[model samples]
Target: MVHNFNSGPSVLPKEVFEEASRAVLDFNGTGLSILEIGHRTSLFQAVIDEAIQTTRELMKLDSDHEVLFLHGGASTQFFQIPMNLLAEGSTAAYLDCGTWGKKAIKEAKLYGNVEVVASSKDRNYTYIPKGYNIPSNATYFHYTTNNTIEGTQMHSIPETSVPLVADMSSDILSYEMDFNRFALIYAGAQKNMGAAGVNLVVVKKDILGKAGRPLPTMMDYREHIANGSLLNTPPVFAIYVAMLTLRWLKQQGGVSVIEKINDRKAQLLYDTLDSLPVFHPTVAKEDRSKMNVVWVMDDPDLEKEFLAICKDNGMVGIKGHRSVGGFRASLYNALPLESVELLTSLMKEFALKKLNRICLRLFLSRHCGLLLSLPAR
Candidate 1:
């Protein structure tokens, strides 16, 4: 079996995949493929409603919040969030911790002033910035909960009176957090939910209409909320797959239980990386992402050999982002612990072989001259 470690469009439960595949062929015995169903049909409506309801149930959200399934991925929210929340002349305090955080900052600046409260860019985002001051006058505090490229994560939710917003594309549903603390939370459906093309949003009801700006029909959160996220045709397949994944998550005893298993998998891989002399993790110990664990060989020259070993051993999507060239193992909810074990075992085997080769070379260097001088053999 292929061990998939893709950062997004990542691994998912086999049961979800099977159910989704069946739906694609013939949805719920309706004799129509999920792909062919109209978005307005009651059948599809049921899918959308259950998805929204299950999302609320899983997060334990109340009537104060509304769940939305939109067409664009989380990146669209970078613009829509500020559009719906940031009024002219107002400022949004952002913690520019990593790539996505930086992107969010850039988008927010288009609508209003953006205060970069804290950043770790100086260290190439090896760690999450902390102890930042959120501006009391700001519209909202924005942050990305996990950095997929840099493999750093914010373990604790920041306490602030200012409204909190998060781009949770890479970490949502992977762990438990205080969902009610955020004024808005958004995520792309690919990482922990489903395939691409859909973005899930949770927004506080009272926060809308406070931005004090005219929003286009599609750009306004209030519009989407009023229309039940059906102002236009949604990504039906993506939402269906996401619903299946959510059901699977419930069957596995929800986020709390999956978190324990995720923790175990991350610990196993990190421990092995620490034990092996050749392999070294890139991110700081305190900030390493449980979802995406990145590491490299101490000797950069051996990266090719190790990657080849990984390929031969049935591992895929272990290559790191281009900006940081190394290995990144994304341990999504569906990735089993045994996959982590296999990767760690490979690391140990590679380290042992390298050590043996070094020892052999040292022995030859020290004794070759003496042996040659004594006699030809």
Candidate 2:
């Protein structure tokens, strides 16, 4: 009965968890655990191969792209992408949408020149920056499709003739997207894919080895691609969980069908938040995120009380990030609409209770003639 809304290491489909549990004990009746089996075995090789194909199928990517399950998170790609693509004199363009975008830009600066096309930092990244100019000769334009920490998302990615790379760690497969538009797409599997152990790299086959640096075998994307994502022992259990998630996604009608559900879930929460008088949404109205809904109450104490009430009502992960200090309900792809409706109801109840308490205290203090009022705090 738990409603999972945590940002990362988020909720998964019930079916995925069930299927994964069975595989761990006896994989394909091999009598050996999926955990103990050698990565070079045909069984494990099928795992990596099918997982990549499922990912491509879900994204509707063509043969122009190569998918690999690398070990490092998307953060590694932030620096590695620039190092591999940008030569000594080359520049890269970045849109400063949120924390991750900013990090990618900073990492790129160490390698070569970087152009910040646009930034939402002036507004605390509450809105997406648009209509920025990309450098004519930049190696690539890097942007984060969804900002996990800030509860913001760029629904329409920026357009660029240069190679485009997206940090889709928090939004990969959450909705239907033109995967072919980007030269590279990377995601850490924690948020929407499966878990935190694996990172997905969907690269354009023609874009690698452009850098003249002496790159090691492991650092090079081509090496991992050639090895089929098992240059060494891969993350055994995480890949299988991702495979299960991909399978579950297919059963639920793939990305296009799931995109509609995601949009509906976001709308349900957003509509409720907009109507409530006590809670205020921080992100700009036009830039509302479909993946994560961030809101805060009029009073900090009230926010705390509301979170406690949500937990009491079997709603978990409703607490806000400590840095932002409000509330963030991440409605990832797998989150059911019932969870959104339940949260909206709780929000209404919390607002009503606060107002009732205030009115009752006011009436009591007013009616007592010359009586000192005691603060509830």
- Measured by lDDT, the strongest candidate is 1
Distance from true location, Cα of 354 in model 2, Å: 1.9
Q: Write the per-residue lDDT of candidate 1 for residues 1-377, one digit (tens) a residue.
A: 89999998889889988988898899999999999999999999999999999999889897899999998899999999999999999998999999999988888999999999999999999999877789899889999999999999999999889999999899898898889999999999899988888999999988899778888999999889988989999899999999988888988999999999999999999999898878889999999999999987655669988999999999999999998888999998889989999998988888898888777666776887432232110
**Least well predicted 10-residue stretch by lDDT in candidate 2:** 368-377
Candidate 2 has what TM-score? 0.95
TM-score of the candidate numbered 1? Answer: 0.96
Model 2 spans > 4 angstroms off: 360-377
lDDT by residue (tens digit), candidate 2, 262-346: 9899998898888888889999888888998898876777777777888888887778887677899999888898999888888
> Listing every candidate in turn, what is its Cα RMSD in Å to the true structure after a full C-alpha superposition?
2.9, 1.9
What overall lDDT goes with each candidate model? Answer: 0.90, 0.86
The deviation in Å at residue 15 for candidate 2 is: 0.9
Candidate 2 lDDT for residue 265: 91
